[model samples]
Every structure is written in C-alpha cells, then in structure tokens.
Target: MWIQEVGEYSKKLLDKGTGEDVVTYRRVQGGEGTKSSQQRIQVNGDGTVTIPKKDADLNISIDNGEHSNYFKNEVRGGNADIVEFDVPKWFDDFLKENTIPQSGYNSNPLNQGGTAPKLVDPTKPGNSFEVPAPWVEWIEEYAKNAQIKK
Candidate 1:
C-alpha cells in the first residue's frame, strides 16, 4: 500500500448553512527547520461570534457599562470591523467590584473641598482656588437633609 502526503495551502472558503453564511481560513506557516502555528477566527451561522469560553466569561465578569456603551456605539453606530484591547486585571477587578461612596462628594477626602467650590482672588500665581467653609457646611447640611450620610 502507498500513501500520498498533500501539501498545505492557505485559502478561505464560505460555508453555507441555515440562513447565514460562515467563512473559514486555513493558512500554512514556517519554513525549512522552523515550527509552524495556525490561528483562525470562527463565527457561527447564527451571526454570533465564536470566542474562547474563558474570554466570554471575562467579558461577562468585567461588564463595564461605559465600555459596553462604547463598544455598542463603535460596532453598531460607527460600523467598525474590529476592536481589540487589553485592560489591567486590577482594572477589571475595580470595575467589577468598586462602588461609589455613599457619602457623595461631601465626605470623601479627595472631595474635601466640598461641592461647587469657587476660586478665590489670586494671592500669588497661576491657580488660587479655595473651598469656602460656608460651601462645605452647606453641602454637608444638604447631604444630611437628603439622608445621604455614609
């Protein structure tokens, strides 16, 4: 018995199924004594994208509303072909778990200047902003009246 080995060729073909058409590709890589790697993107006939299960889960877990809106706008409104990104793991955790402080801006150290602060008269140079004690008191009192204490 004799067997013949066929050489690999790079090509794309359309697969017909259900109602939607699917496309697939096969490519050959490497040369001589080197190793070869093949990568392909697969899409289902129902128009759903095929990605690794882990990636899908990461998408669900990250679930950033801002990023979700941006993606929808870019893909649906802007009609982009491809969007790719890398976000830090900590950022994913932050988006998944972080919450807005219930104290509003009045109690946060970063917002110690209070809400609607105004700049004071220039005492020396470029920027001379000051948080008025009256504004801080009013904001705190408003927060208290609004029952937003935290």
Candidate 2:
C-alpha cells in the first residue's frame, strides 16, 4: 500500500508584533517510517518570506501563479494547485499594483496577460497547491498581506 504523511496546521489571528493573521503549517517528510523535521516560515510586511531550514525571502508569487495556471494547461501530474477564493481586498490590490504591464507589441490581438492566472479571488472554490504545508509561507503572505492594511 502507498501512503503519505502530512503535518498539522493552525491559524493565529494576531502576530506578536505585527498583529497580522498568520497561518502556521507543519510539513512531514515522506512515508510513515521516514524521519521528518519541522520548519517554520514567516512572511514579513516587507514582501519577503523566510523559512528557517530553507532559503529566506522566498517570494513564490510566481510559484503560486504557475500552480494556479495548472488547470488551464494540465501538464503537471497531480490535480490543479489551490487558488485562493477567499482573497482579502488589500491582497487583491497589491496584485493589481504589481501587475506586469505589457509595454511592447500588442498591435495584433493575440498577446495578452501572462501565463499565470490573474491574481484575484477565484469565482469558484479552487486549490492553490496540492501540498499546503510546503507552501505555508505563501499562505501567510497572502493572509497577512491582506490584513496588513497598507
């Protein structure tokens, strides 16, 4: 039989100093017999994500964007990644602020938005990624940034 192990997750309404809502997630390694290490990730108000055991300042906006586009293409093996339907208003605004403008070209009617899905709340319930634990930073970034209230 094939099985995978997963860690637990919890959401905190207020951070110690920032008082932003944070989602803390624990991730498991492999299978039942495999040894696992717990990692903590935090998203700063500065738009940088830090993972203790992994690299710090991982802004996976692109990663989340790519995963969000999985269904439109389906090249990836597993199901489509999770798309945030409960996106907060400010987070939506941030995405709007960061829109990579299409400067050149455009005479034809073919070129348009980038491959990644537009950063916005999905019309229907959607998945961002299959494994949420590894993407804890993104979750918190999206969550905290939404509540940060520029």
- Candidate with top lDDT is 2
Could you tell me the lDDT of residue 120 within candidate 2? 24
Positional deviation of residue 105's Cα in model 2 after best superposition, in angstroms = 14
lDDT score at residue 113, model 2, on the 0-100 scale = 27
Which sections of candidate 2 miss by over 4 Å? 1-73, 79-85, 102-139, 142-150
- The TM-score, computed over Cα atoms with residue i paired to residue i, of candidate 2 is 0.25
Overlapping backbone residue pairs in candidate 2 total 7
Expressed as tens digits, the lDDT of each residue in 10-52 for candidate 1 is 1112233333222111111121222222111223443333333
TM for every model, in the order presented, reads 0.18, 0.25
The sequence of per-residue lDDT tens digits that candidate 2 reaches over residues 1-150 is 001101011122345546544432221111122222122434455544344543322222222233334333333223222222122333433333333323332342322322221222223223122212333344454543321110
Residue 140, model 1, lDDT: 24
